[model samples]
Target: MPRPAEAALLSTSLIPTDNSTYEALPLVDSESLQALITHEALNASALELFAIANASVKEYGHPTRVIGSGGHYKTLGWIEKQLKNMSDYYTYEKQEFKALNGMVFNHSLSVNGVKVLDEKPFQLTPAAHVYWADLVVIDNLGCEDIDYAPLNASLSTNTVALIKRGECPFGNKSSLAGKWGASAALIYDPESDEIITGTLGTPTNTTVGTLGISKTLAESLIAQKNAGVPLKINMFIAAYVGFIKTKNIIATTIHGDQDNIVALGAHSDSVEAGPGINDDGSGTISLLNVAAQLTNFKINNAVRFAWWAAEEEGLLGSNFYAYNLTALENSKIRLFMDYDMMASPNFEYQVYNGSNELNPPGSEELKQLYIDYYESKGLPWVLIPFDGRSDYVGFIETGIPAGGIAAGAEGKNSQNGEVLDKCYHALCDDVTNLNWDAFLTNTQLIAHSVATYANSLEGFPLREPPKVASSADVPYKFNLHGNFYIM
Candidate 1:
């Protein structure tokens, strides 16, 4: 989508794949407001930005974007300097990662006479108490009214509880079941379809060493009970606390009405296992591209651009910012739009379902804005549940209306197809692993959304005080080696 420069004005000395070519690429003039908001202009910017990231990876390594690392800090600093060159409205904030040191669990269960306990180091419930116990399946889904009576009437002493996932907070389910005499708890998808992993809300938070299970396993155990077969399972968990320091980069327009702000964000850090180019490089670069173009135009309502850190580590960076805001500061934020992954190799256009599921007041309007854009373009899109899988987690938690788009992540390309973004969270998610078409398409949408709200917050509702909720209520399903569970 990049426009070719006039050959006479361009030098033939630089190689297109070289970093020098990226440095030599033309950027929109700071006063060119007309060029700034145009979709083609932003897409062109994104192409060059991607070149910069590819260069960063080449200079560093596959795991180059880990938070607080020298490579990550230096790269982020370079970006900050670029923003400063365009405008003087940027700052950085540092936060401790508050390390969740270690979690080890020994689980044992029998399915159809097959003993399936491999002694894996399962993720622990935050601050969960150390314990070992036999397990029992609760009669009611583990969402509400979890009393010991049903658990007691179903199983004997020291029996762990297996409850379906829904309704109440994850920690709440374990806490309530523990109150009723269960030594530990296991929460699984009600449909028994996926593997789920999540935080227990906070580092110091405690619960009954709860474990998330696959819907398949839970259903099997339930069927065994129904067939008058005995179901005995054992689970043990141990955990400790620790911290890592990270930083967040925030930029705001100095010329707009600062009282009513529109914020957009994307996580900049990658996962521990990979470079996370598609997982987040896509989102990070898209916003950076938008931010660079926006410097060309003045706005009515102030717009803030945030490059969050440690989002893959359970939305830590955004959580710190939102949680630390004063009521007045929070209210100034009309809405928060999050962009995580935008160019999965096996791509699908996904718009966050802000209106119905995570209805943070004005979220529906934001959702419709995206829907209308895709519809107008004659491109099909699916509404994805606004689960707290990325930085938007913190924004929605703060009751700040939020919405955004994603190409695809580790999910399937279709019901019968392979995993979307085959290299997701893998080392292969490098410079060559993106869908350029999807990337440009989504980048244009980012420009549209940011420009729309920046010019006017008309239909975008104002914010009220936020009541943050635990993210465990919305389960993320994962299929590991064909074993599906919530993550």
Candidate 2:
């Protein structure tokens, strides 16, 4: 990695004073970044959950609740408590922490529908009359101690598997379950509003299931079993099956009355391991702060904010959200700004220019946005090829303009003027490992571009999509699945 002092000096020295286009744009403040980091560090529920599981806080003499015992609980209440603590610590007034009833299935096990195979231990078999097998009730299972071997074996034929939702990695378990054969997986928590979906890894040869249930559902099923009552479940897996219910949380602020919209987004869900602070919490929090700060600011176009879920699972969330939009909605979307990993401590930042040769839909304008920000702030940035690794993939493939920023990640070598942040997705990605100044600067740049695009009288100046070259004209053709275009 570049020396901090050198990076700072180089960044400051590169300011472009001659540029009159964006001279008056506001820069991100270090204090804001510090405040965000502090808040994220203290309040991020994901991080706190991991800390409790790993017993990290136990060493500090304040042990967190366990997964299943009397004092052990995982509820939205606990999450709210943590959020409140952080808000109080940071003095954030009017802070509202809400855990929405995100999604529901058509078949969630209920006491009146399932036939108990073994009444003593409570084993169940579905009734023939039930059309939709939405819920699966398992006899004895804990998210932590459940034997996946049986579940894996059963997945080959089972559309859904009922499992407890504590102590296990939902993403990995869900992937394994999917690999075996299940169409969807449900993990109910004995305690909280932590309704987690299973993380799907890379696309598989066979498309089986699409969604995962929360721990709360599992607890409900267990209660039904204990009561010796059959459970009835109504399951509505989103039409985009094998990947159902994945969603992108989108919010928009119109600059003026412009029809064109500049979309800025980041995937909100993290890998099941940690709260994904650096992997995405950094980006999510940054975007939130920027949006909050820019809420009243004047803009000419529309600035949209989206927090995507299930991105860690093969970009399913964003893909579903983007593809499901109506034709009118698609036409209104002018540009896509994606921020995936934006605060890695190991590497210098990079801006992805849609493609190397021709600019992608909104590549040029996005590039100019970053360039203006860096030049005005005297920061050094490099433009690279779009790898289609994040939520922007759907937009770019649909020919919508797309560009994004990235911090470092694991396996990204510190080569070609890039430095690697080794702690990319590990638990070590705490605030201490981050360069707050860089984070703040990058956040400001993102916010500024969003604001600029919104305020510009001309809608996002989109370049035509690159022409599809014939196979003969193509130098090399890799057997890739999606469309690859130049920016």
Candidate 3:
């Protein structure tokens, strides 16, 4: 018996482009270090530093080399050797702060060492007496039992508060805390065990100081407060404020005679944690592969691929590029596709149809396109509610057609009766943990969909006049089943 074609998939070569200038844009060379940054080992500052240093050295007349070879691409010593190899072109330097800054410390203390200001289960001493802190520490303050009106009043004079972890949600707590007059808030762990960190939603209203600390440190601070000991702790934090310049690397290929454009994008910036391979490296690589495969195909409408920067800092890069477009350019845009996290082993695939309230112009057609492509390939998929969680937010906000696929993220996965990919936004999200089979399949689907849309003669496959629907007219009703929802 012979092996099936899908079982023995062969890599295809990208079609050569006549436009040499656009071809010059780097397109996922295996040697590129962008993939390595997905490991969560490198923080955003380090990634930025690496990009700046690499660009500077390249311009300084050093041998044109791929920057991804350092770190995981090679052995530690080999990585050092590569850096040394480029030493002639650039100098590596680290700056130290005069004050304890850019550093976070975790500490724990015995229960005997701490004092209880209040016998009540949750109440703690006021922030004024705690540490003369720019902010006060109030751990585990949630909305359920605890009333925040008093705390909010107390915080107005102090301007800062640190809440211990657990109980209520962070966003709700942050919202309540903001009402109480806090400039910033830190949520530390109660167990005093491992470091606790997670996403703090968009800081739209108030500038609330947010930080994660270990349970050990929280307990230690509590103990000190109880003992009436004047506790002195040190922490170093660094943030750069003001306008920073970044670029949106755009690579496009036009096939057919259509005037409309279909855009696919993935942000390249990693958070201040590790290389963001799963965070977005997976999406970036998938799109890059799609681009490489499309190079050979001639299509009608333009297919534009982009690797955006500064996405970690509030979608700055993508927003800037999308909004900065001229009237002519905006009109030419047909649909925007975003691939943020398209590969998580534990969760099923989903398509984000921008806002259920309104079809949002081109979303319904794009959703059908994804569904049809998945069906053609005999794959199972689900449609998820529209979320402005990625670069797609910009396009949707501007009334441009937008849709994309997400494998699984940090949320729970009801279909498989499993937790959502736990490694999301963590240092554990490396390639070793990915389900490559799913990755490959999803990547292929993305490429096929883009190619079909670009080749179709009906410039934009989506309906031009937006469809209006009332709650009674809506065809699908979602039923919540355990952790998963059935549509």
Candidate 4:
């Protein structure tokens, strides 16, 4: 192998004004680079990541890493605690932003005065309290005013609309209830027996607080109505809606070249459905573990490791950081690499093709590095498009050459036609959700790439002069298959 440059360590939450100390980066010798990349460290960290993502699974029955929840805060605290040990070589900072979040604190319901324990609360809606409300089953999705015509009973403030989930956005359902003067709405999944959990997208001016119920609950209530029974129901939903403060955790190495930089990031937040271990816990933990091990050696370019928040809500945290960067600050960043879902249970080795029109010149080079690394190891790899599916989008759109890697998630593996991660975005995405081999190999690749870049930016293209950062302005939302999109 031709001798490569020395590797750098991760650092920097925000770039400072006038980082004019641009100097030459020295290559890290091959031996030092090899020393920084180790199997033992990656394996050890994998064990810890599984435990953390699954930490509350047995006790609470789901992950605590969902944003705005107490558990999510604790998980972030745990990361900070880990970084404390490496205080001697690195520093960390936080990026705070206003994020619309919801927490379903408590929910309860009763049928004919008998309490029903099976229920789930809707997010981003206000609290609901009703007593002996008239139960009216909206026959069709309340998307249009004509749909509510089938509700024979005259609507009143005490009306509770029990609607099925389908065809329209949940926000539309809740808003329609308001138009009908229904004080509260209960949505249920007609197909699945599983209790529904979701957000109303954004804060709705409508006073119709929404909650989700299982098919059984809806069926039981509907059956009672069919039998000419006047069903009096009582419901309570203790919830919080509107904006909450959450932050991105950024760390930088005080050891490497500060001006010429390499950045790697992964989101730290999980969806309300589960811990998101394989979806992104794999990425988050890998960066943390690598950042810890990186302190042992020094390199040419400075490396910045960011644990982004609200990526599940449309890459908000990462975009905020990228979009705000001044042209001068953007020039210092040689490459920005993103790693997400590196350990999908049903796996494939995939790298961003970086073919987006706006991606700076070095994108192909970044993709080639991963291609070359896997090839050298006699491993198979595939190319994925720079589809703006993850955190790398903002930087790449702003004229930065960005590339990322993912084992796979939701996307199918052509080799066997298996879903790359069946547990993706589900509660099952916990301790057992990862492909250990993929996890280990990808992380090792991160260490190798970081080390090489830190040692020298030799074969990489010069940073494109920074332009105004931009991304799709559409709302970020969760699709039916549990994937997020800019649609």
Q: All predictions: root-mean-square deviation over Cα?
A: 11.0, 16.5, 13.8, 8.0
Candidate 2 per-residue lDDT over residues 308-417, each given as its tens digit? 65555456556655555555567777778888776676556687766424435456667767776677767677775566557777676555677888766643444553
Estimated TM-score for each candidate = 0.64, 0.51, 0.60, 0.70
Instruction: Report the CA-based lDDT of candidate 3 relative to the real structure.
Output: 0.49
Span of 10 residues, lowest total lDDT, candidate 1:
478-487
Residues forming the 10-long window of minimal summed lDDT in candidate 4: 1-10
Q: What is the lDDT of residue 212 in candidate 3?
A: 55
Winner by lDDT: 4
Which segments of model 3 are wrong by more than 4 Å? Answer: 1-148, 152-184, 188-208, 213-243, 355-357, 457-487
Compared with the true structure, all predictions reach lDDT values of 0.62, 0.48, 0.49, 0.73
lDDT score for residue 114 of model 1 = 54
Give the candidate order by descending lDDT.
4, 1, 3, 2
Q: Can you tell me which runs of candidate 1 are displaced by over 4 Å?
A: 1-133, 145-150, 154-156, 203-206, 226-238, 242-247, 254-260, 268-281, 293-301, 309-320, 326-334, 344-348, 352-365, 384-401, 407-436, 455-487
Model 2 misplaced stretches (Cα beyond 4 Å): 1-246, 356-359, 411-419, 457-487
TM-score of 4: 0.70
**How many residue-pair clashes does candidate 1 contain?**
15
Report the C-alpha displacement of residue 217, candidate 2, in angstroms: 41
